[model samples]
Target chain A: MKAKVYVMLKEGVLDPQGAAVQHALGALGFDGVEGVRQGKVIELDLATGTTEATVREMCEKLLANTVIESYRIEM
Target chain B: MKAKVYVMLKEGVLDPQGAAVQHALGALGFDGVEGVRQGKVIELDLATGTTEATVREMCEKLLANTVIESYRIEM
Candidate 1:
């Protein structure tokens, strides 16, 4: 089965990369742009018997850094 | 208002970075993992009256490369 995970910076984290993008957007004529937070999406095709718990562990252990990010898993 | 955008590779695109991560996962003892696809999530804090249509256009024009990826918007 396919599992999709969304990983995002926790609230209050400063995203310099995203800020750079936002600045570029303004220079490129997108005046209405406000703020941007950048993150990652990881899609996994898992073994047939893999449990959600295992996937969640994967996110916690390797896929995301809980110190600065949070993750949600979808099957 | 806040808008969340998800940008992901097309179904058949090769994701080398994701493959690298999967390989590392296996080396780190996550044996049941299979395939991985990498993508991006961009969160936007918009002006109060921003329209979803404008956000969608931003995704198409700058946030994602339609040649290889697709995007979704959430309010």
Candidate 2:
């Protein structure tokens, strides 16, 4: 099984890296962009029959910082 | 419109961050992981009618380093 994890900052958290990207895009003259949020994707190649619950535990334990981020998993 | 851009290192690239995460997971007793790869996701909020071409341009010009990374865009 393969698992893909998306870890993104929470709604109220400020993302400086995302802000920098948005600002740079404006400087490049593609001004249609209004907002930007940057996140992480971790792809795991797991043994067959690895359950989604195990992947979720990985996210909670190490993949994501729950205080400032939220994560979703796809298997 | 919204664009979700995923930037990942090419297959041949060495991903030390991913290796570290995999090692950590093993230390934490979840040993089914065979491999791991880390990537970035950038979400863009654009004006309605923004074309996929525009997002591709962003990836080519700034969002991804095409020499070592490949990017996919979802709108």
Candidate 3:
């Protein structure tokens, strides 16, 4: 099975990278972009029987820094 | 309105970062991980009426490097 993890900054966290992208968009004449938040997606090809709990453990251990980011897993 | 863009390296492209992550996971005893691919997600809070075409244009122009990456947009 395949598991996809989306790791994003928590609400209220400042995202400089996202702000930079939004600024560039505005400069390029693509107005109306009011906010931007950048994150990461990690796709894991897991062996059969690898449960969702294991994926969550992976996220907690290595995939995300939970202090400022949150991760969601889709199997 | 909101737009979420997912950008990933095209298949057959070498992803060293992903390989490294896989290696780390294996080192940490995650044995069933067969493959890993890393990507980026950009979430945009758009002004009302900002069309999907505009989001695609942004991906084409700045959010994704079409030569090596492909993007999917959710509006």
Question: Residue A24 of candidate 3: its Cα lDDT?
Answer: 97
Model 1 misplacement above 4 A: none
For model 1 chain B, the run of ten residues with the poorest summed lDDT: B25-34
| Residue lDDT tens for model 3, B8-70 | 999999999899999999999999999999999999999999888889999999999999999
* Rank ordering of all candidates by DockQ, starting from the highest: 3, 2, 1
Give fnat (model 3): 0.95
Tens-digit lDDT track for model 2 on A6-61? 99999989999999999999999998899999999999999999999999999999
Docking quality tier of candidate 2? high
Model 3 scores a C-alpha lDDT of 0.96
Q: What's the lDDT for candidate 2?
A: 0.96
Ranking by lDDT: 3, 2, 1
Computed on alpha carbons, the lDDT of every model, listed in order, comes to 0.88, 0.96, 0.96
Question: Candidate 2's residue-wise lDDT over B1-75, tens digit each?
Answer: 788999999999999999999999999999899999999999999999999999999999999999999999999
* Alpha carbon lDDT at B60, candidate 1: 76
Report the lDDT tens digits of candidate 1 across residue range A9-47.
999999998998798777767777779999999989888
DockQ of each: 0.79, 0.91, 0.95
Better of 2 and 3 by TM-score: 3
Task: Look at candidate 3 and tell me the lDDT of residue B24.
Answer: 95
